[model samples]
Target: MGGASNDSSSSTTRCGVFELSIFVAAIVSGTACSICSKTMMELHGVGIDGTMELFTKPIFQTFGMFVGMMFGLIMHWAVLVLKIPFPGYEHTSALDNDQRPGYNTTSTNYGAIQSEKDQLLASQASTASTSNATPVWMYFFLIIPSIFDLGATALCMMGLRYLDVSIYQLLRGSGIIFVALMKQHVLGDRLFFFQWLGVFWNVVSVILVGATAILNSNDDVDLDPNDAFWGVALVMAGAFVQALQFVFEEKVMSMEDAAAPPLLLIGMEGFWGTLLCLVVVYPLAYYFPGEDHGSYEDPFNTYEMFMNSNTIQWSFVIYFFTIFAYNLFAVLVTFMLNSIWHAILDNFRPITVWLTDLMIFYVITETGDFGEPWTKFSVVQLLGMFVLLYGTAIYNAPNAGSLKLEGQWYSFGFNLRGEYEEIELEIHEEELNREWEERQQNFKARRTSSLAERSPHTSIHTQALRGFASPKI
Candidate 1:
């Protein structure tokens, strides 16, 4: 009876292990959701901004998007030739798996639930388990974050008119703390104590920086009606949107079956968003005219002819480069975060990628460009960087831990010769493990049916260790 019970327990554990593997697969594609954010930002910033004048202006965004993508493709090709350093590969310890556990795979899912109940249940069902019905709102949850993110971008850009970069950074950095609440309450994931500490430290840094900016500035930077409140509102909205996106993706969007490829989603998003904004904003501009009636550019300069006409001031070139660097970074980081096995650990890898863009932006500012970097580093400003760093580390820590707990989802930590090679090896490993486990179960059943109850098999012990073991050592 005892032997029979053990077999049942082992079968249950095997099922759970399979379910977790699926969850990890889904989480990997969650990065595709960022296409929605990117599309929304461009729509509001350029599409909706000049509103009405653009209708006669020609549907240029579609073309501009294609052109922009061409540039991105060229850059990607160039980077391949240049062999640009991808940051994650350099920093991640190849031997972490080998050093910690004894598994052949210690690098798979980052947020594997540690509880036995979750594991067993996960093995038995798909993501939409009968125990917890998926919230109906989940269908539109992705859209909610997109709207807020666009709002944030517009607000921050507008806030820039009134506030200095230092002030804006302070406010912007504060967004992550809101994320901690989302992660805990919405996603129901229990973060480590240090992770909370890291978040607190980051938020405190932003507050301190803002206080310093207020104390030092002799004048308040205020803007016109169109620019003031709406700008601030947008950025705050963006922050909330960002926080919401992370939580929703973790809970609902990150599933094993993906709906579309990254570029396909990005393309559709850009096309739809541009069309929708034009439809909504153009009518409003027609009757309740704002910047729509007459744009800053000349009358003949329709959106269609804007690029060909020499109407683009040299100053806008500076802006284009800034956009070029920032957008490129944003798009690439999104791709990397999506493609990886344990994105949850480096959860805010997007933030780090954004900061790198900011640093590049600072250089543009320092060269007496349209952008300006703040000269004096207040104590608060310095602390914000530290907090950001710690927060990123804390988020990533659990990813490693999760992989340690679930051995079924391990990835070869070493960088492969090519993307195809990497994928093939990963699949091969999974198949072999499945066969290995089946054989072991068969051996155990044979031993039991013969009625000689045996001790725990060494192979079984080793296999369990492999689930938790490090890949490198």
Candidate 2:
């Protein structure tokens, strides 16, 4: 037993260490990706003296990201083809054998019961029809997520042009609000009181962050309030779109027959995204006039700039590699740990990006040439950051013990029917009644056995005493 316990503890420790190392890699890669992307847009060429920002093409940046995703797909295939022993390498079964849990018919409402039954039947039917091999037609469902990804990435890149990296990162917290709302309506996931509270705090954090960005605009950095407002709007809109993508991906992946491996799904999305950018997004960017006639996105000009600039070309390469690494690490983190851990990692990413931005601006390039400089410190921004982190922590907290909050209050649900809880209560009451009856029966049996063991005279006398005590009843 001692040896077994020791082995278990040792295994857990090693696992923890490995996960920690992966998390660190994820942070580094993610931070590097963000900084590289921002630098590509902001950094000037070595000899070019004009104010021409060569990499101001948000559409091209989006295209590069999809290309990176394609590379990720290739890498995934390579691992499979080589039979490499990678974590999360095994694909999920295309069909699930286990049926969905049934609702408590005694306590549940007719409507909810019927709905659950219908869903269960549908799932069973699908699973029964599905073969071991994933259907080719199901792969096309990935296009939906890919389209959402395109919108989200393009909008964010466009917004990144107007905002600081820190602000851009901070504003992303708003996505949780959209996700929460979508989960409730689209996925039928009900939020507990604490989660709802967390959502509220997240909203407050976003508002604070946005206000700080607008009010504390740095004149030295040529920060405009109007531009900042537009940036916040764009980033928030992108976050909303990204939230939709997340919810849709979850919904699709949860399906019994349609589920695909994470890497394959990402790869498919990338493939579709790249094709869409080339055929649709790029063409639209070329023909349609933007804010300043290609100032925002001109595919032809982007091509020219890419051809002429070595720095731009190298930045794109770095961006591609970093994006791939970040996605790979992210998927690993999610597979090894839980969604809560992934969320925590995401919360940490902004801090890493913010600190790296400060280092680059203040220590590495004191002239604001390589990256945007940190604006004058604001107590509000600092407070908002803390609040944002706190809100995120609250949302992802595994239990009330983790936050030292009242568990009952935190877990309070607003479901009017309370069907599930009622079922549980009924079961508990039945168990208690059964145990009480068993105890009474045992007591009577013990008394009867004691009487039987007594002598006949003693038994008669005891019966006579019981009869006298019963008063002729």
Q: Which numbered prediction scores highest in TM-score against the true structure?
A: 2
Model 1, 440: alpha-carbon shift in Å? 11
Reference-based TM-score of each model: 0.45, 0.70
Q: Which pairs clash (backbone N, Cα, C closer than 3 Å) in model 2? A: none
lDDT of 1 by residue, 10-61 (tens): 1111213433443343323322222222222222222333432222221232
- Report, for every candidate in turn, its global Cα lDDT versus the true structure: 0.36, 0.61
RMSD of 1: 16.3
TM-score of 2: 0.70
Off by over 4 Å in 2: 1-24, 45-54, 91-131, 218-221, 291-296, 332-344, 399-402, 407-473
TM-score, candidate number 1: 0.45
Q: Which candidate should be chosen as best, given lDDT against the real structure?
A: 2
Q: State the lDDT of candidate 2 residue by residue for 1-473, as single tens digits.
A: 00111111111111245667788998999899889988888754332223355467688888988888877677667755664434534321112222211100011111222344345644654454344344688678789989998999999998888877877877876777887676666555555555566677778878888887787665445577888899999999998997777666544443443445456667888899999999999888777767534434666566666767888889899999898787667655544443234445555677888888888878898676765454465556667788777776555444222232343454344332343333335445645664685466445434432212212222222221111111000
Provide the RMSD of all predictions against the true structure, rounded to 1 decimal: 16.3, 18.2
